[model samples]
Target chain A: MNPFPASDYIVAAFFLFCIATTVGGAFVAILTARVIRSVCGLMICCVGLAGLYFFLNSPFLALMEILIYIGAVCVTIVFAVMLAEPDEPPSGQNHGPGVLWGVVALVVSAAICWGLSQLSLRGPWVAPAARVNDGSIKAIGVSLLTTYSMAFELISLVLLVAIVGALVIARTGRTKP
Target chain B: MSLPEPFRLLSFLVGVMAFVGFNAAYLVWVERKSAARFQRRPGPTEVGYAGLLQPIADGIKLLSKQLIVPPGADRILFMVAPLMVMIPAMISLVVLPFGGSLMARDINVGLLMMFAFGSINVMSIMLSGWSSRNKYAIISAARIVSQDVAYEIPMLLVVITLLMITGTMNLNEIVQQQEGWFWHWNLFRLNVNPLMPLTFLIFFTCMLAEINRAPFDMAEAESELVAGAFTEYAGMGFGVFFVAEYANIVVGCSFATVLFLGGWQSPFGLWSGVWWFLLKMYALVFTVIWVRWTFPRTQFYNLLNLSWQLLIPASLFTLILVAAMMKFL
Candidate 1:
């Protein structure tokens, strides 16, 4: 009587969709000539990455990825795009070294991508014997406070320094202009 | 045969869409009438009874008009902007509790989900501005992002302080924590923490800014900006943004109500249930409208200053104080 695929199949289909989004988004980001479109590509990649995070059983990380990256980072990139330039200027046609550099760059990137893929696909993979924790929000809170408290405080300190430095730099820029 | 799960979700989405459509239209009418009353002028009494049908007429007019995509606009991005604005506002409603077990989907990190979705509205707005390629739109968009980032810090701090007290991120659980007599509401958490009222005020101000409502609506200052980021958006593209704005307002109010106003908990024991929730939410929306008509918009620099200079430090103080009180008490 069932017309739709089972839940597992749906999950698998969605997983494939996420992978496609990630790969396609990366392609769009690099291949696009316009900087604004590239920014949009990054946003799409983040959204797909967030989907992958969701599938990994961490909704909080998924939401944070979207909230921070797409919401803050991408928007900042867009602002820079608007203020500076909308599109990358055309690279004038040059013959000898330009072709050489393009081929070399392509080869290096392809090799790196291939190596990473091979390493991931062929590496030793095994399921854990049993779960240690449910990985709920409360569990995360407790872990951060108890086990990872030092790292958390360090991050806060780092953020404080970054904010202060940004303010100083921005204020200086204001005075000169 | 349809999968029952998706079918249910589809129906829920349909219901929510209907609600959003009806609410947005009715709100504009409410706004017009309220503005009229303030100025002692009759408002839209022609369409149906007391201008009840005016929204439909406006909708028809908007739909009938030519959707002029501005010259040299980025075709795809320009069209997608309104969808970006509306979708998040729609998705956020899924986690909201209408009454007892009344939410479409009660995710664990419900409050965080709302904030995450709410943040996307600004991005959509920026995209709309840029795609149009208008100078005023670009300037308005610039103001929006800066204002958003400044106000968001205080908003998150206020939420952090609230979570510290309630000790959960689930909206339903938060409401349950504040259940009981009227005094037990988080707004009047006077006994537990005296700083809540101020937090509420700060949070509400940030909410007004976040939704780009008036006084804080620096992005849409009509006098200077020429309709701001939406200058080039015409027809239903513009209509979608308007609808999304009101939808966000409703969602923001519901979130506030759930957090601070004891959710659906009646002020008195006699008047209990979902009606109370509706009343409280509508009351907040009404206040937003009333404030819009009453006050002149703030200067952009002053708007940013209010968030950074005043609100951020105050919310930070409140957060620390609340934490200390939670520890000492």
Candidate 2:
């Protein structure tokens, strides 16, 4: 008799579901000819990823994944779609070159995925010897004020620059209008 | 009396599924009520006991609505986008600790994994915009990319600060460290230093931006963009996005609780920590909603500038001050 219960099967099944969702969504996002369809596929992929994050033990990240990506990012993109013309212009059939490009993109992405998967699956992972500290919010705070303070400071700077840059770029385009 | 491992895993999965479904429902009600209060309107009062049945009603309505696809749109992608937005929202709940023992797994690299999965949101949005074959969707998608890139940096920095202090990424462990009264909470009193308040404030601000709540909801500015990237979505497709958005709010509130409010730690030391944690999280969520309803939507350029100019610099300054304090004090 197997020591593991049937619940483990359930867990495994859920895991499989998440993986399938992610991979399938990604496939649809990239392979589908319709750009809008591709966007939907991407949303599916994100939802699957959020599931994976939940599995991975970071509920916070999972929520962030959904909130930031689905709530804000996806909605924004939808608005842009309504504003900008995204449909490909119709042209006479040119399957030969299109097929060639499609094949090229597929091969490149496949090779990358395969290589990364193999490296991760086969790579030697070092298990930490007796975790020194529980990475609690307190510890995170302590370190933020001490060790990684510089990085924290720099990130803010980058945000500042990005904000300014976005304003300038968007504004410059509008003056001529 | 030993439970088999498989049974335990099965129970966990069931529990998670229940949590996701229930939370999704609860959040919709919460958002409506919250939005209503903010707008000085009585929201969803007709359904079961002060609109408690509103979510069920909404769910039924959505379920019955025709799932329509626009002509000339990619039928397959149109069908799938909502699922893309939703599944991730559901999946990301695994690592959240409802209490000390309530967690799916205690992964060592929990922090990194969360970020890796989180980045996929951008790609998904971009795809939705592209597939929609609409000009507005394309612009919204471009804006999302720019906005995400801009805000993510400060958010990461804030997270990095937490990681550094904690010396580990396990969410449970992080909460465990903040035992005892409110002072023990990371936000209130950090080693008797006043500067800690600044850190907390910076973290919270960055979080608001990260979640894209106002004054940062430029992406879906209804007045300007007409529902933004989701303009093409209808019926259940729209429904999924709706649920996902509220789910994201829960996630952000939960993170604030975990990072600063002392996850599961009771503020008064009298009640169980879980209650306090929940209260803090909900309170934060309320604040997000409150801000959303209160502020006029920011211009897209101003939104970007807020991140790049204001938040980024302030965060950087706080980081340096913290480092200096650590070194000298």
Candidate 3:
């Protein structure tokens, strides 16, 4: 039998699952003193976000999320870990300042999360009248050439600059070593 | 569009679980075989003849292995990291269109949704590295973020070009527009010109960088990073990250197929769309593996320079040419 009827529930469950994973991971990432645990938490969060992408209807993004984030980003971070000493030195007497900083971070993050959720859930959204194009790959191609040509060109330029800038920055640090 | 709630929920649950399991197992097998051929060694040949049963054996071995948590490591966070890595990889599959009609949901803001979800991945890695209390893991995390910042912009620019051309963010519609034969595919020139082909090449190259295959895989260079962010992981924790990586490969291949290779559309009129789509995707995946083994890794700075100097400039030039062609010629 078709399980379509339960789709809403499934969606809700997955959504909650992703949120829990992300938030929980973030909590662990930030709260735990051990740097490795934080990295693990970050990975968990990304995985959840990937799930959210799937729900959002962009499998490509989901793949990119995992590949770029987990495969590339996480691995790169691990490399940095190996290169530098990043572990938090055990604190002996600075309890007050640490607690204050923790409180400040918690309050700020909570406020932002609450505000965004309220805006998203309560804000009025208008539906588009009639879909202009099917939004297919072909349609995207046509539009790139015809409508958004300037922006497309600009992105290419931006990429060029980023590549050059990254090279320059990374290169500058090398001569000293 | 309304339907009963229970069945839909059941189907979704089943679908997610099944796809996750399949993607995890199959991708491992694919990666092993791919790596084996690239290295000129027989990979997993003893297990089920050419390693067909290798994944099964691996699963059993990993499950049996003792999951050793380092004494200094944060217990909960360490346990959670691999799940963090894997969940995103599994979740991202929903939006991918295996066939035109086969998708989880066709959201209006699909593109933005993807980027937003994607940004969180770096945070997880940073956290894992910091939490591990291991020096190597911390360095790997920092490198991961830097590399992401370096490559993400170019990759995004490439996506924007595609979005501009199609005028819509929906993946299905994009594929539909390219229906017909191979020429109709966006990767090739429709009118026999050099610009479109060049665009396709640039996009393909960017895709490789985005996927972090060799030449771009500086983050995990075994000789340098010593297993990078995953140096501390073992058993299922490691397994989760491994599965996520393979899933990403599948995702990347699928995107290439859809964007350039006419996703699910028949190359010739005789066959159906799904078969052609799979062929194209597999071909791209194979190419990824081939390149990984064939080329030596690039220096990090050189890698960054390639994107900025070569890919960015070339893409920009092509953009101008495409605009000019569209306008007059």
Best by lDDT: 1
Docking class of 3: incorrect
**DockQ, prediction 2:** 0.14
- For A98-175, candidate 3 gives per-residue lDDT tens digits of 899989998999999999999989989664334556545566567888899999999999989988998999998799
Per-residue CA lDDT of model 3 for B1-329, tens digit only, reads 64454555457657866766776797677877878876788888888877799898988888888888888876676776676666555555556667766667566545544544454455555556555767777666666666666666666666666665666666777788788877888777555336666667666676566555676776566788787777888887778776666666777678778777778988764565567777888788778778877889888888778877887777766666656656676
Q: Provide the TM-score of chain B versus the true chain B for each model in turn.
A: 0.97, 0.91, 0.88
lDDT of candidate model 2 versus the reference = 0.71
* Count of backbone collisions within predicted model 3: 84
Cα RMSD of all models vs. native, in order, equals: 2.9, 7.2, 6.9
TM-score of each: 0.93, 0.71, 0.70
Which prediction has the highest DockQ against the true structure? 1
Clashing pairs in 1: none
Winner by DockQ between candidate 2 and candidate 1: 1
Off by over 4 Å in 1: A1-5, A86-104, A126-136, A149-161, A174-177, B1-3, B269-271
Give the per-residue Cα lDDT of candidate 1 at B116: 85
Which CAPRI category fits model 1?
acceptable
Worst 10 residues of 3 chain B by lDDT: B111-120
Model 2 segments more than 4 A misplaced = A5-177, B1-3, B192-194, B327-329
| Model 1 per-residue lDDT at B315 | 96
Error of 3 at B325 (Å): 4.9
